[model samples]
Target chain A: MTVSTALPAVPVTAALPDKKNRRGNRKNSTLATVLLLLGAVYCLFPVLWVLIASTKSSGELFSTFTLAPSTHLFDNIGDLFAYRNGLYWRWMANTALYAGVGAAVSTLVSAMSGFALAKYDFPGKRFVFNVILAGVLVPGVILAIPQYLLLAKVGLTNTYWSVLLPSMISPYGIYLSRIFAAATVPTEVLEAARIDGAGDWRTFGRVVLPMMKSGLVTVFLFQFVAIWNNFMLPYIMLGDDHLYPLTVGLSGLLNQGANQPSMYITVVTGALISIIPLVALFLGLQRYWRVDLGAGAVKA
Target chain B: MTAVTALPTETRTPRTATRRGRRAGAPYSFLAPALILFVAFFAAPIGYAAYLSLRRVKVSGLGLGAGARTEVWAGMSNYARSLTDPDFLPSVYRIGAYGLIVVPTMLGLALLMALLLDAGRTRVGTFSRTAIFLPYAVPAVVGSLLWGFLYLPRVSPFTDVVQMFGVEPPDVLTGSWVLWAVANIAVWGGTGFNMIVIYTALRAIPTDLFEAARLDGASDKQIAWRIKIPIVLPSLIMTFVFSLIATLQVFAEPMTLKPLSNTISSTWTPLMKVYRDAFVRNDIYSAAATSVVIAVATFAVSFGFLKLVGNRAFNQED
Candidate 1:
């Protein structure tokens, strides 16, 4: 920054940000690199540990260095797959179902609510949005027991809906959606659609939905990771082991590791297995991770 | 769909206003699902909690039969007991200390990582960003599980790596380091989202701000501290409030770590106490009171923090 100020004829883009600052940028970048690497190590170490530990046989798990990879990789996964009628796989599928389906529906719900809040000037719009603001502050723990009881009233407790239903309406998602709708979807287009005799629903489906795609993706990922990582809700909601998501399942396995030490290996293996898809999803979908979700639609 | 229609000086314009009046109902219809869910899952729970907090079953002589106990109004006794409990205060203090450690460091690391990523400086920014965010994908339980194993003497690579140097790995899940262990899990899970948020706000800053700052002979560090940080302070506050709220409700990591360590208690944090009251002790009344306290504290602290910072990002209504 200072170099650009100090120099007269530096090409702006290639502007040596500040010749003196060049040294600073280099130092800062180095510090930044090291800090980032430290963060990466902090994050990746445990994951890396799990990866390596998952490969070791139960015997080797406690006998050797933790980072040393063993040849029992396939065996550990095979053992995990074989355990309790392949409940591990069921948990994985259930997690995918929870996160994937939950996020999709959540995104739709939030999108609709946000669009309404942003686009329509309704009598109770302010009131509704304020309620959402309050909702955002309400902790999930407070709702868990009540959600269970409410679902129990409808005889839906322990069912997938108990978990899925509560997750569908994310206040944060709705908040983000409103911001996106207000910023991106111009009122003129909706008015034009109205002038062309398109109904509100039709216009929303055709014109508004497309404009909201990017923001919706962010909403989807947020809800996706949230539901995927959620432990307590499903832990309380689902009783059947078959319905257990990875978090609850792995935790259960870890609790058993207290008594049966071999389960530690399984828990380690399961932890590694559980993280694979989400990490892959996060990495693969990096393009969709709009740093500015609000900005995504601004271009539209 | 209001338009300044090219109209003659109309005798009356109530038609457009009436049309808008009729259309106004449509937005509520769209918002109905969210409202219904909010009422059912959010409002009703809170209402129920508060209601139940005021009532508790009192058993008579033997404390035996179905009708032996009757729900009676306990007034604010439950709240008083919960508030005054020795365990409660320490848990709050622990969470305060934990929050102090987790919030700033996590947000700082996150902000720095975000700015570095945004600067497009290094080759591994994308990789490191994803690696850092990878924990976000890992559920707190799973992250705790992974970290818990890493902290174990037998499984820790640090244990083995240091054994070569004739030293044991520090018992991270014990002693003062336990806080760091829990905070580390939080930092890992939280930093990415906060980073993304602060990054979003940073990205929202008009480039002209940077261009002008650059023209002022500001260094990149100065530009970040002066221009970027101030511009994104709202985001920082937003993340801070969210982190503070989340820290208050710290649950899974410690709960998972409890099986691995003797250090963590059932009431390690406030919500953990709430969980114990709600589940283990089957004392939802006091649990409800604790929940109310936590919710109020969150609102008050978040609101106070926002007011202090004068950040209005969360003040949006509809």
Candidate 2:
């Protein structure tokens, strides 16, 4: 199993003679730059609008100039926080717990299963991998209703475990983990650890995991974002507002906005706050998102 | 290679046999948690859904007593009802239109941006890339909420700009325009991630592969069309499949826009219908049947797509 570990090559176009191609190249570059900047503006428009809009009082939200800044940002946040004795903050905490703990456990599970699949020669390995791959295509809607029913039978519905347990087994994570294990953790190190009288578990814990650290970080981040962004599973499983994630909580708040127009301001403010952690995480860990869909397809 | 080389030296030792035996069992132990979770969460739910889809409650004598409501085999009645229901087909058609609008436009923009970014000719590439990708960090619910407000004429800058031209801005959340409005939210939230995926694939292409085209005096557009696109076709196919799957399950965005817009019904999408049935109306059997139909359709579409594409994108080695 060969892994493509080639570093990105510097573009040959960069070294082209500027004197001759300058006219054509500059024209093309300007067009590309303008197009790209337009795209950037289109994407950033909403986020900027939200930031400016959240600062307005409820009365000003519809009446004021669309882009005008106001002094009611803290007031809106205060109303959001003060709603129903701080239910919004509880949703925030629930989101953190679900994404944080769920991703951590999912990463560990994927790492272990992936290492085993990559390293070990065993009966039914192909069958195991194939089954898990099939799980990837199964729609979540097919599972969510039944999962809720089954969990209801067990009295686990509307609980934290209802959301977290279903999130642990991600076939995509295991698949990526397998690739990372094969690419990063060499067979020699495992053999050396075994020869040095270390147990398999210890060797895996001490050697294999650290070697797959960056890859595992990628896995963790993907799962973290997935759990954080997930609305269907949690929305189906948990009924209690106290246990709702930001997605469910905000949607519910918006539902109430029909009667009370003031809830729209709170909803907007909550939306602004809800996106900060993830956008920050995404920006900080920009380099870790090395997604190559063709990697497995072209090679495997 | 080291394992094979070390095999000759280790085979003579009796301890090596036991070690190999233990190693054979190690993978199963390692895989146990995932397997257990898979069965409990994925396999069990799917099986239970299928089972429940084939059965229904038989309520006798005005449905007054617990004993009168007996569980009985329903066969295909639920499926028959679901397929013939007025709401089900329209939801499917709505999503079909939604997918048609979303998948092409989003992927086209994604491909265009990816090619432009990979061309390395753009100024503010980093800023555009980050900014475009920022929407992905926002959840669908939040993204929809933001866009829902933006669609409101009273609060919309687009409306404000149009009014300056002595023209009225059409209500985006009404009529056929609402479809475009909903589609725009999806396109906005999705284009960045797909762009990054395609961009990553583009970056992986060896520069030498394209240097020859450059030497031949081929234009950037020609090289992008001729060389770069074919190389990333597999990634494109992959993103298409994922995007199609996501498109079929459009719920949150439309659901979020519901309060703001009366145009969106309770059954705006098939998944939404399933949600309405299972939770809202307490019709789990029909919901299960509809979900089964959805699951089967998803499998058929994905598998059929792969097969139609000659299965080149996912030819796993044994």
Candidate 3:
């Protein structure tokens, strides 16, 4: 790994020469490239289909070829906006609000709790850590029904708080933040801050947080994507269409496709539009996408 | 708190002891939010689900007014009903089949892709990696919708391609093929993320370790089979476990595809059965019992698999 990193821009294939049988090596390498490209095509086909499908009108959607692009992109967008007096835009905004606000608050809470678990010694710490770890394995889908029932008892169902409140408590976020805090924030610096008459909160907010900036961004992106992509929780929690996130909203539109054939185009358009933000986030934050599952990040 | 930090440590007094007490309290104070949320959302829900599973609604005389139907203890009747429901066992079997198809295929493809990318010979590694991972950014609902359109006869370019060769396209959304259809959706969305994980692990292995194998006249496939696969077995095991968990809880893809396919029942999977029992059939008690059953099964499968495997992947004792 170090050798490959040092020789940047030199392809790894260039180093595989055996000083004999060059043609056979070239053929094998070409085969590998073709096989990889085929895999790429398989993965990108659906995304490409959605991109082209969203450009077609209701009539052209069934009438024209699947891959052919039409000039109805703006018309489809206009129709999606005009449907139910701009309800699609509302779903988009609701999704952004849920992911943005939920992730922000979740990140802060996880940072605090994870910092405590990583840096400080207290009674029952191991118990708390083990329970949170168990929470990580608790399949979140199983909790949806019970959470809905409990929230309904308190008259909190079908409300934004039903989704946002639960979204703010991500066990995986805390686990990642704990690893990040343990890795990035040094104990010597923390002790120095404490010796300089800084309180715990002040030291954490001013010093520890800055060191954990990249990891916290990773945590925020992860929770944001999870909440954004979530369907079952919001589907069970919110009864009203106006409160629906993109997943629930688009699914409802797809469900309506059995009766209303035109909704197929709308669902396609909504799916295409909904994925733009996530794909953009992925491309822009490519470096922070590293999730070291083998505990290497902490051990580093 | 700052004042306590400023106090002199030379004099071991009660004030110092109080500062030590405050230090002990700091971690608890910091953990207050997570602990509260965990208790409310995690622990409370599981407990309430168990309680609801053990109880049922008992209707009184006439069963008309607000107080007519009261909640009462039902012992194990709800669990008995849920376990005996004809839909329940089939749903479990369907999920078992789906997991068998999905977990191995997805992880195998993921492992293959990771090994190919790690082989360091493919020219399109970066492009293919991003393209394959692009689906992870798309939501399952949206991904299913896209694939659902592709499965349709009128909208599928695949059908056109097959027809161009004078062959009929197989109906992918039919009863016989719906499992594979849903499994494909899972594989499409899951493979990229797992590939990245395995690829990250593969990258962590030093190139020098494999350089010696190459110098010994071993081919790329031989090197990957002998050296790379064994070194990344832990990562593969971890991915397999996670894929198993996710496969068992598949709800979104099948739910999204139900609008298109007649084969998918309202209770297609165990989680979906829980959904229908709770929301569609208005049987929250039975649903609670079924969810508990599914949760227990999941934990058993996961922990049992780990215990059987001797926990070599996650041996972090420290």
Candidate 4:
């Protein structure tokens, strides 16, 4: 009877503000919807330009309507392939190897280090973590020159190792893994594993590893994309055209295009093709990356 | 492979240290692979470059042989020469000009988009947001390549469309417009990440704070400026720092685009200058000196700006 009396008065109390809230929300939403569509169009325009541009023939590329589609993508790709004995294929493969293999190894290294740092008690742990943080601030570009010289000293320059070896450290990846480990892995479970006679290595490999998988995947993706997008390190490291990744190989072609104006079509076509795989990968993996990546910028 | 070779500890004695010290070994052990590579590649090279910068080849008798040319102390001469070189100033000036165009436009678009996303009324919000961020996955080299071809008179569909109106298409790769052309590429590639950063900070905000404003009949723009912007100011500062750092290191786009344009010099950027000195000129000393200069400039600018901003960005953590 007391609750019934309180509810009839409560409904009137809520009703006035609810009416105002609905009006406010309706106004806010319509304005938001228009703004969002405009922002999306600005973002998508360049991509649309490339798509339509890629379809046209060399002569039609500039001659046709900017948004109009033509039928030359297939021929443009054929031309791209025929150049330098299909060297573009080599670049694609090289990119996959560098990013795919390097990110995988880097993620594993970061995961183990992060797990140990987060779960285990150790001396100088603070110092180690701080050092990793320091490494993060130091731009990778500064390290590139020295890295090149060092690799050259060991006769590693012009080889794939020149690019792959340095990328595998990823201080940032380790920093991320540590955060992930702390958040995802429960302390009591690991302690129980140790008490149950499981070795440290076994516990990490079996018990902690599975728990850190999602975060580790995020770490791997970050590193993979970073390595794939990396231009300077690979640009400076590899000299052998045969060893060039897509970036270096494509840049070489662009350089040659200055003298041969017609090669512009080929470059545009290649750009369109190159983004296809990663765009597919991004769309596929978008759901898993809802976590705040800003907070996740690896401390390295 | 690194996975196999780096596995299996070289020394296994059931590693022991004090509780505080025990974690020391594991991080170092995990970091060992990175450290070894770091030293071999990063530290050693930086040291070598510094060492090289302080020394130069003393060529004797027309520099006939390896013996005739000896590495001797150049002692600030290469740095002095590099500093006085007139070519260096224009690169700095150009970057300043380029940064002026890019930083504001990119961040402005990012903030606007982030606010819209936070407004939460748009359909396919996820799809749109992801599409905007898609270019982030494309490498700088790839991004530049895409834009480079689009800038071509014969290759630009926009040019085709513009020409249909009977007006000549603008030459983006030409003088004056080249900066915009390059700046556009940076904007395209960078806006997504900044949007994500800004968007993440917005998402992290407690929602009930806005519920009151809604009751007060606040417009979405009013809520964004009066409420959201103030709340995410720190993230903005954080983004500003990162964007500043990234802008200084801009190299590959111009470097890649240079092959297609005569306007981009061999020394179009500070980093590019370093590459040319080291590899092209075989002046490792000069390259080292230039790199150290750029690195110092980077740190100085960042720390100095922090001081000017009253040191708030990094104040709380310490």
lDDT of each: 0.77, 0.85, 0.83, 0.74
Cα DockQ of the candidate 3 complex: 0.46
Give the range where candidate 2 chain A is weakest over 10 consecutive residues by summed lDDT: A2-11
Candidate 3 wrong stretches, greater than 4 Å: A1-28, A296-300, B1-19, B312-317
lDDT of 4 by residue, A1-300 (tens): 111111121123323432333123432366666666666676677778888888888888767767789888889999989987898888889989999998998888788877766666556767777667656656678878878887788899888888988888777787778777877787767655644655566777898889888778878988998888888998888878888877777777777777886887887777777778887788777544433444443221
Candidates, ranked, DockQ: 2, 3, 1, 4
Q: Where in model 4 is the C-alpha error above 4 Å?
A: A1-31, A291-300, B1-27, B154-170, B303-318
Q: Scoring model 4 with DockQ, what do you get?
A: 0.28
After TM-score superposition, what is the CA distance of residue A191 in candidate 1 from its true location, in Å? 1.1
Q: Could you tell me which residue pairs clash in candidate 4?
A: A66-B157, A122-B20, A122-B21, A122-B22, A122-B23, A123-B20, A123-B21, A123-B22, A136-A300, A146-B45
* Candidate 1 runs further than 4 Å off: A1-29, A291-300, B1-22, B164-168, B212-216, B316-318
| lDDT at residue A231 of model 1 (Cα atoms) | 85
If the candidates were sorted by their lDDT against the true structure, best first, what order would they fall in?
2, 3, 1, 4
What are the per-model numbers of colliding residue pairs? 1, 0, 1, 10
Please identify model 2 stretches exceeding 4 Å from their true place: A1-28, A297-300, B1-12, B315-317
Q: Please tell me which predicted candidate would have the highest lDDT against the true structure.
A: 2
Give me the candidate number with maximum DockQ.
Answer: 2
Clashing pairs in 1: A3-A18
Tens digits of per-residue lDDT, candidate 1, B1-318, equal 332122233433465455444455667767878888778888887888789889888999899977888899999999998999788998999999999999999988888987876564554555576677777777899888888877888766667778899986789988889999899889888888777667656656666767776777887788888888877776677777788878877888898999999999899898889888877898878988898888888888877876897766765431
Error at A60, model 3, angstroms: 1.8
Residue B37, candidate 2: Cα error in Å is: 0.8
Could you give candidate 2's fraction of true interface contacts?
A: 0.66
Per-residue lDDT of candidate 2, residues B24-139 (tens digit): 67888999999999999988988998999999999899998679898899999999999998999999999999999999999999999989877877546667778888899999
